[model samples]
Target chain A: AQSVTQPDIHITVSEGASLELRCNYSYGATPYLFWYVQSPGQGLQLLLKYFSGDTLVQGIKGFEAEFKRSQSSFNLRKPSVHWSDAAEYFCAVRFSGTYKYIFGTGTRLKVLA
Target chain B: SQTIHQWPATLVQPVGSPLSLECTVEGTSNPNLYWYRQAAGRGLQLLFYSVGIGQISSEVPQNLSASRPQDRQFILSSKKLLLSDSGFYLCAWSPTSGHQETQYFGPGTRLLVL
Candidate 1:
């Protein structure tokens, strides 16, 4: 079974500071990884995805993630944080031939002004 | 461009009451539809998915059921609602063919079962 784990439950960062959210997955093979963000009372928006090719994938809103196969980790990073960037982040994993995606518990990001 | 829509934006229902939630997709055909629930402070739990009309696949055995009568429409229903069912219900769609594996989400429907 493919499962994703987000170690941080909540993270607080000051405006203009860098941010990193950790995500680890347990899968038999290299799975399709994705990062999504959800605002309060809103649906999730895709931030980035990694299917193949480069380990580092850039996404919307200046977000980027690096897939590390050896460590089974796909961590999201942003060079600078803004107050509007506060939201819940989730990591999802899907197998090559499957449609079902397994999501992590999520990490709540709080950006301070 | 594909878009997914779920309604009503918010719902309040009593326990033991019947439930119905609708989801529809536009600008796409033969897409895969999915129903997911997010409990308070929890991640998404996929309830059901469909690759085509009348082909519903359940990911979890629960009090809810899903049906796809049309290629673009999906519905979630329950004979009797439970308190545990009170959560944010989301609808998503993805291309069954092609190289697009990303699922686009709807605005979602928030259900509160009293």
Candidate 2:
């Protein structure tokens, strides 16, 4: 069956360190990919998304994701982590234009000053 | 520009009590609405979605029920609340037209069942 996986359940890093969150999907065809961030006691905000062209996609708050078809991965990256960036990140995928979205188990990022 | 609204930002109910949560979307039309539950330290679990008024599709079999009385209004209810029903409830809306599959989420409603 098709699914989305986030191997890391929790990650901690020092401030100003680089960050990478992995997202892998199992699907026959190309799917729509998205990354979202949620702060404590709040709703989720869209970080980035990938549709068709351009493997590298940039998003708000200095975040980017690269979509690799061969590897079936869309990993999020940040050059320098901030203390305020400590939050939970989620990866979601949709096979087609359908309304249903499959979300991965989320990864919680903790930043240390 | 579209916006979503969820009422009763926080709710506390006892077990066996009834549940009612309202969600409304403005600045758009013919949107695909969805309901999701997010437990503590977990990702989102899709509960229900609606394409049009009075048309609902349940994703999981649970004690929860959803209804779409108006085009932009979606409500989630339960006849009797369960201990497992305590979580953060979110309402979302996506456009039906265009290939824009992005979903806009509303401020979640936190439910605590005692």
Candidate 3:
């Protein structure tokens, strides 16, 4: 079964500092990875996705993720953290040409001023 | 540009009461629709998904059911609500024929079952 895992349950960072959230998935031949962000009491918004080609993918709101095939990891990163960026982040994985997507429990990010 | 809508934004129901949550998609047709529930402090649990009208797929054996009556309308229902059903319900839609793209999400409807 294909599954995703977010190792860090909670991460705290100072504003204007670089941030990275780790994600790993069970080994699969063709894994389509995605990152989503959810504000408190709001639905998740897609951050970025990786289907094929480049290992690094850029997304909305100045977020980016690098899909490493060898490690089965898709880690989300930002050059600078903002107070508004404090939210829950989820990593989802889906096989090619499939409807099912397995999501991680999520990592809660806290940005300190 | 496509959009998904879920309502009534928030609902409060008593245990054993009936439930009917509606989801619809616009600016697109024949898109795949999905129903997911996010329990408090937990990851999202996919309840159901539909590829076409009247073709619903249940992911887990649960107390809820879903239906896709029209091309763009999907509904989640339960005959008698349970306290476990209290959570945030989210509706999402993806392309029926694509590269397994990202699913677009609605604002979500918070359901509180007392």
Model 3 per-residue lDDT tens digits across residues A1-113: 77899999999999999999999999876898999999999999999999899999999989999998888999999999999999999999988768888899999999999
Q: Of the candidates numbered 2 and 3, which has the greater DockQ value?
A: 2
What order do candidates take by lDDT, descending?
2, 1, 3
Q: Lowest lDDT 10-mer window, candidate 2 chain B?
A: B95-104
Chain B TM-score, structure 3:
0.97
After superposition on all CA atoms, how large is the RMSD of candidate 1? 0.9
The C-alpha lDDT values of all candidates are 0.94, 0.94, 0.93
Model 3 lDDT at residue B59? 95
Candidate 2's error at B6, in angstroms?
A: 0.4
Clashing pairs in 2: none
**Candidate 1 lDDT by residue in tens digits, B11-85:** 999999999999999998999999999999988999999999999999999999999999999999999999999
Model 1 segments more than 4 A misplaced: none
Q: For model 1, what is the alpha-carbon lDDT of residue B99?
A: 58
iRMS, model 2 (angstroms): 0.8
Instruction: Give the Cα RMSD of candidate 2.
Output: 0.8
Those runs of model 2 whose alpha carbons end farther than 4 Å from true positions after fitting are: none
Q: Write the per-residue lDDT of candidate 2 for residues A2-109, one digit (tens) a residue.
A: 889999999999999999999999965669999999999999899999988989999999999999998999999999999999999999998784778889999999
Model 3's chain A TM-score stands at 0.97
**Two-chain complex of model 2, DockQ on C-alpha atoms against the true structure:** 0.81
- Least well predicted 10-residue stretch by lDDT in candidate 1 chain A: A25-34
